[model samples]
Each structure stands twice: as C-alpha cells, then as structure tokens.
Target: MDIRLDDLTHPAIHALLEEHMAGMRALSPPECVFALDLDKLRHPSISFWSAWDGDTLTGCGALRELDAGHGEIKSMRTPNALRRRGAGKAILQHIIGVARARGYQRLSLETGAPAGFAAAHALYLGAGFVETGPFGDYQEDPFSRFYTLAL
Candidate 1:
C-alpha cells in the first residue's frame, strides 16, 4: 500500500470521509462526535493523507498541528472490507512520522469510549499511545477517551 497527501477532493476519499462521519454519528451522540468534516480537514494546520493499493483507496488519516510541539490525529478511517489489513496501521504510522518530522514532541487523539471503539483503542495502544485526560481545547467528557504518545 502507498500513502500520500490527499487534497480531499477525490470521489473515493470524499466517500470514505462521509462513511467515517456517519459511523461516528451512529456510535456517539451528535455533540460527542468529534470527527472532522471535509471542510475542517482542509484547514491550513491539518495534513490529510489517503492510503491506496494501486487504483483502490484503502484508508485515510490526518494530523493537525495544535501547537509548535504538539499535534492531534484526526479523521482516521479504514473501510469494513479493509479492516485488519494494515491499511489503518499504515496511515497511522505515516501520521506519526509526519508529526515527528514537523518537530512535534507529542501526538494526541480523542476517540469514543463506546464498545464500538474497542478496535480503535487497541490500534492506538498498540502504536504506543497511552490513555490520557483531555488535551488541547477538549474538556472532560465521559463519552470520550484521549490518548497521547510522546515522540
């Protein structure tokens, strides 16, 4: 699989992001769903990427600079058919690499606390992220679990 920066305009990437947002909405309350929409993902501080296997889109992920020394992971998603195929892991590892290259000292993310998020929790944990309290603009929310990795 090859991963590269994405402009978020490709039909496949658009559809994937829509599916990701839909899944988030189904798993968490509207207010608790923090997944970024396409517009938000286009922010200057954010770097979005898509993973592909030749002509097929496998997954996507993004990194957003929160401060000079910190960054946040956003919009990570892999299709059901691609789950456990290393697509998500590749995108995550790519994001971590970019964060490190940007001189970030820490990388953080916020995911849902529901059972549906177990796989996500495991993925982050396996990638060396540790459970932590809210960071950046986030506040205490029982429905959210935060994780951070010190680079």
Candidate 2:
C-alpha cells in the first residue's frame, strides 16, 4: 500500500472519513466520539495521510503535533472493504514511524469505550499503546478510553 499526505478534497478520502464518522456515531454518542471532521483534520498542526492500494483508498490516519515532543493520533480508519487485510496496521505503523522521525517523545489517542469498539481497543493494544489518563483538552470520561506510547 502507498501512504502519503492527502488533501481532504480527494473524493475517496471524504467518503472514507464519512464512513468512519458514521460508524463512530452509531457506536458512540457525539460527546464520546473523537473522530474529526474535514475542517478539524486540516488544521495546521495535523499531518494526515491516506493509504492506497494502487488506485483504491485503503485507509487513513493522522498525527497532530501538540508540543515539541508530544503528538496525538487522530482519524484512524480502514474501510469495511479493507478490514482484516492489514490496512489499519499499515496506517498505524506509518504514523508511529512518522512520529518517531519527527522527534515526538510520545503518541496518544482517544477511542470509544462501547462494545462495538472492542476490536479497535484490541488493535491499539496490539500495536503497543497502553491505557492512560486523558491528554490535551480531554478529561476523565466513562465514554472514552485513552492510550499513550512513549517513543
């Protein structure tokens, strides 16, 4: 798969993000949903990437610089058509690699706590993220689970 920074204007990226946001809404309430919309993802502090298998959009993920050495993972999503095919893994590994290269000392994320999010929680653990207190503007919330990794 080819992974590279993407412009949200790309139709496939928009469709993929819409699918992801819809899934989050169905699985969790708006307050608990950490998914970012196109405007948020386009922030200057965030670097977003899209994974493609030839011409097909496979998955996408982003890293947001919070400080000199702190970063956050945002909008990680692999389409249903690409689930179980290692697309999520590829996107995550790329994000981790990028974080390390950019001198980030840690990477953190927030995911839903609903049963429908169990697979995603497991995937993050498998990728070496560990549960932690909330970061950034986040607070202790039963609806969300936070994880962090030291780089």
Candidate 3:
C-alpha cells in the first residue's frame, strides 16, 4: 500500500471522509462524534493522508498539531467493506512515523468507547498506544477513549 500526504481534493477521499462521518455518527451520540469534516481537516495545522493500493483508496487518517511537542491523531477510518486488511494499521504507523520525524514527543488520539470501535481500539493498542486522559481541546467524556504514545 502507498501512503502519502493528501490534498483532500480527490473525489474518492471526499467520499471516504463522508462515509467516515456517517459511520461515526451512527456509532456514537452526536455530541461524542469528533470526526472532522473535510473543511475542518483542511486546517493549516493538520496534515491528512490517504492510503492506496494502486487504484483503490484503502483508508485515510490525519494528524493535527496540538503543540510543538505533541500531535493528535484524527479521522482514522477504513471502509466497512475493507476492515481488517491492514490499512488501518498502515495509516496509523505512517502517522506515528511522521509525528516522530516532526520532533513530536507524543502522539495522542481520541476514539469511541463503544463496542463498535473495537477494531480501532485493538489497532491503537497493538501499535503501543496506551489509554490516557483527555488531551488538547477534549474534556472528560465517557463516550471517548483517549490513547497516547510517547515518542
């Protein structure tokens, strides 16, 4: 799979992001859904990436700058039809590598605490991210599970 920085303009990326947003909303309460829309992910502090296997868009993820030493993982999603194919892990590792290269001391992420997000939890934990308290603009939320990896 090829993973690289994406400009967030491709029709496939937009469709994938839209599907991600819909899935998040379906799995969590509206207030607990932190998935960013394309506009929000396009912020200057955020770097988005798309994972592809030749012509197929496998998945996508993003990293948002929280500060000079920290970065937040955002918008990690693989289509329902494509789960468990390693795209999730690949994109996550890619983000971690980029964060470390940027001199970040830590990489953090917020995901749902619900059972529907079990795969995500496994992926993060398998990649060495441990459960932690809220970071960045997040407050304590029962519906959210926070994880951080010390780089």
Candidate 4:
C-alpha cells in the first residue's frame, strides 16, 4: 500500500472521510462524537494521509501537533471493503514514524469505549499505545478511551 500526505481534496479521500464521519456518528452518541470533518482535518496543526493500493483508497489517518513535545493521532479509518487488511496498521506505523521524526516525545489518541471499538482498541494496544486518562482538551467522558505512546 502507498501512504502519502493528502491535501484532503481528492475525490476518493473526500468520500472516505465522509464515510468515516458517518460511521463515527452511527457508533457514538451525538455528544460523544468527536470525529473531525474535512474542514477540521485541514487545520494547520494537522497532517492528513491517505493509503492507497494502486487507484483504490485503502485507508486514511492523521497526526496533529499538540505541542512541541507531543502529538495526537486522529481520523484513522479503513473502509469495510478493506477491513482486516494491513492498510490500517501501515497508516498507523506511518503516523508514528512521522511523529517521531517531528521530535514529538509522546503520541496520544482518543477512541470510543464501546464494544464496537474493540478492534481499534486492540490495534492501538498492539501499536504500543497504553490506556490513559484524557489528554489535551479532552474531559473525562465514559464514552471515550484514551491512549498514549512515548515516542
């Protein structure tokens, strides 16, 4: 799979992001939903990436600079058609490498606590992320599970 920085304008990226947001909305309550939309993903602090296999969009993920020594992982998604493939893992490893290269000492992320999020939880855990309390501007929400990795 090819993973590269995305400007968030490609039609395939747009569609994948829409599907990701929709999936988040369906899985989490309105108040607990924190998935970023296209506009938010384009924020100056964030770097978005899309994973592709030839012409097909396989997955996407993003890294957001939280501070000089810290960063946040965001918008990780692999469409149903490509689920269980290595795309998500590849995107995640790419993000982690980018974070380390950027001089970030730590990397964090927030994901759902629901049973439906088990796969993601396992994925993060396997990627060296440890469960932790809320970080950054996040408050204590039972619906959310946070993870952090020391780079």
List, residue by residue over 1-151, the lDDT tens digit for candidate 3: 9998999999999999999999889888999999999999999999999999998999999999999999999999887888889999999999999999999999999999999889899999999999999988898988899999999
On residues 45-104, what C-alpha lDDT tens digit does candidate 2 reach at each position? 999999999999999999999999999999999998778888888999999999999999
Off by over 4 Å in 2: none
| Candidate 1 local lDDT, 1-118, one digit each (tens) | 9998999899999899889999999998999999999999999999999999999999999999999999999999998777999999999999999999999999999999999999
Q: In model 2, which range of ten residues has the least summed lDDT?
A: 26-35
- Candidate 2 displacement at residue 26 in angstroms: 0.7
What is the TM-score (0 to 1) of candidate 2?
Answer: 0.96
lDDT of 4 at 142: 80
lDDT values, one for every candidate: 0.94, 0.92, 0.94, 0.94
Q: What tens digits encode model 4's per-residue C-alpha lDDT throughout 47-75? A: 99999999999999999999999999999
* Model 1: how far residue 111 lies from native, Å: 0.5
Candidate with more favorable, higher TM-score: 2 or 3:
3
Backbone clashes in model 2, listed as residue pairs: none
Local error of candidate 1 at residue 1 (angstroms): 0.5
Overlapping backbone residue pairs in candidate 1 total: 0
TM-score of each: 0.98, 0.96, 0.98, 0.98
